[model samples]
Target: MSSLRAYRQIVRRPSRKIYVGPVAVGGDAPISVQTMTNTLTTDVDGTLDQIRRSAAAGADIVRVSCPDEDSTKALKDIVAGSPVPIVADIHFHYRRAIEAAEAGAACLRINPGNIGSEDRVREVIKAAKDYGCSMRIGVNAGSLERDLLEQYGEPCPDAMVESARRHMRILEDNDFTNFKISVKASDVFLAVAAYQALADACDYPLHLGITEAGGLRGGTVKSSVGLGMLLWSGIGDTIRVSLSADPVEEVRVGYEILKSLDLRHRGVRVVSCPSCARQGFDVVKTVATLEERLAHIEEPISLSVIGCIVNGPGEARETDVGLTGGGGGSHMVYLAGNQDHKIGTEAMVDHLVALVEKKAAVLAAERAAARAAADEPK
Candidate 1:
């Protein structure tokens, strides 16, 4: 146990623990993926539907903007119906934070600088403490305090770090330590630098993201670059890929980042070749179809869709399942690095999906058996 603890310490920063519903954040917990709903919070059914979708997409925590009375009032239904924990994003309104707490929010996201006065900040903290809810002091470059901007001329990395420290001080002064912090900037360099500075300055678990990261393609790349750097350096404890697209896409990107680092595995990882002149199949369309079909799958498996048989079998060795094209519209299937059989090109996708489903079922059963064995007698 001591050795295991030491290993964890070596891999991640040490920070106090906080719970958002049943999921743990900070020390020793697997880094979690989070996303915010774009739906109007007052639309309880719509918001709850988005929440359930985000949870199904493997979001460990979901946040909704609580900017008004209606949104706050709707929190009860959202929280009660959500599959995962909900965090209320309260800006400039301490009352909403209080209401969200009363309505069973698992966490409250508050920016102390914007929440009216010091007294208001304290009141929000008190509400959080009373309800046993965690808080996130989100410091965005777009909304840093004026004094810091005047002192630094812009929302530089230092200014962002200072802003986070200020909000953190407010929570600390109120003896409210059940909180995490995020210092986000639109610029990837600034966001990464600010997080690095904060990580050195304190032990609080860092919530990592590059805010307003454009649309699906642009935002995914931007977030992957920024969050990827922080996560690789062992700085982030929880992450949100702030894309201006469906919230579910954000959760998908978060897991991809974690999966790429071998830190966490929550879905199928499709590996395909870029296709060259020697290629034999329509690898592009096949890969797209496979990805679309496997988007919502939660099982962790590697599937390689190669274009030709020449280099395919060798590449397939690293994957759980694979397909390599044969001559004249035929294909060879490989399962767990072995040649399974041959099939027609038209039937390849369905065949691969069936093989994957079978493997996923067996994997699930093995996990259940192992868990049952562990819980039994010893």
Candidate 2:
């Protein structure tokens, strides 16, 4: 009886459109995926190379930390060489925000409260406007303002939302509307509740994230629970899965979240059944190997790996391509839901990967042909 029908009824809030370089972040635009760079921003070439890798991995926007003048100065080169839009992460330094804007960053992310006076915030805003860059006010529980902490006794959801409101009001008062907001907490519940409150308060697009979300496994779960709730409620505009691992992993997790929600499609989606007593062969290892090989493939395709013949065919029937384990060290290979042939278990992984590559080529060609036909006049 579980359904997505009622979830579809949630109305998305209206917000003004803003561009972070070439990617649109709000106002009916597709929810964007972002990741920050772990490379020292001062290493211009290394940073640019990582940015390219992130863009190639399906990241929509990239953020670089500008912790000092050296990194701030290197922003110009990084921005010039970056394949995707770049945002500068500034903390407790208004001048660095100004420097990053002038260096051609698409956006500047700063915590207004931590960056000092109202005048300093305005100075950063003025620089952002001058450079035609947007701003993101990132409010995290670990860094909430002292007064708000004293008033609320903790960095709770209400306190976080209040901090966001205060920063937002300052920017709005300066007539700066080209900005987004993020209120992040390590606690999943706190993060979700803070976003819900902000969604009800204003239409400024939200950059969803759970701050300090642990390593790959823990971070993925925390971010999914918090961001999934907000996205399901039509509350997030952009997302970053803050993992302690490589920044590229963050981009991958972001896309996976969007893919699960049916909001964005990128790379292949694999469906594999857990092996049971009825399983005929080693389905787990086969599926894992295939997944590793296809990690970088961006074309959207579905592949199912089932353990037993009983429910395998029926389940695989719905996928683009599939494999079902059988006896005698052999397996059934399915293409477009039809049993094509039987192959030995040792060769199954390679065969399926080759089949997928062949199918991907055909799909790519068909898409190109369609595009070429569309360009031709009647």
Candidate 2 segments whose C-alpha is farther than 4 A from its true place: 1-11, 369-378
Superposed Cα deviation of residue 162, candidate 2 (Å): 1.3
- Per-residue CA lDDT of model 1 for 1-378, tens digit only, reads 798555544266788778888899998899999999999988999998888888898999999999899988989988999889999998887899999999999999888878888888888888888898999999999998999999999889899898888888888988988889999999999999999999999998888889999999999999999988888778889999998899999999899989987789877998898988767778998899988888767779999999897789997888999888778888888888999889898788888888888888888899899999999995
- Listed per candidate, the RMSD to the true structure in angstroms reads 3.1, 2.4
lDDT of each: 0.89, 0.88
Top candidate when judged by TM-score against the true structure: 1
Clashing pairs in 1: none
lDDT string for model 2 (146-169, tens) is 999999999888898999999888
Q: How far is candidate 1 from the true structure (C-alpha RMSD, Å)?
A: 3.1
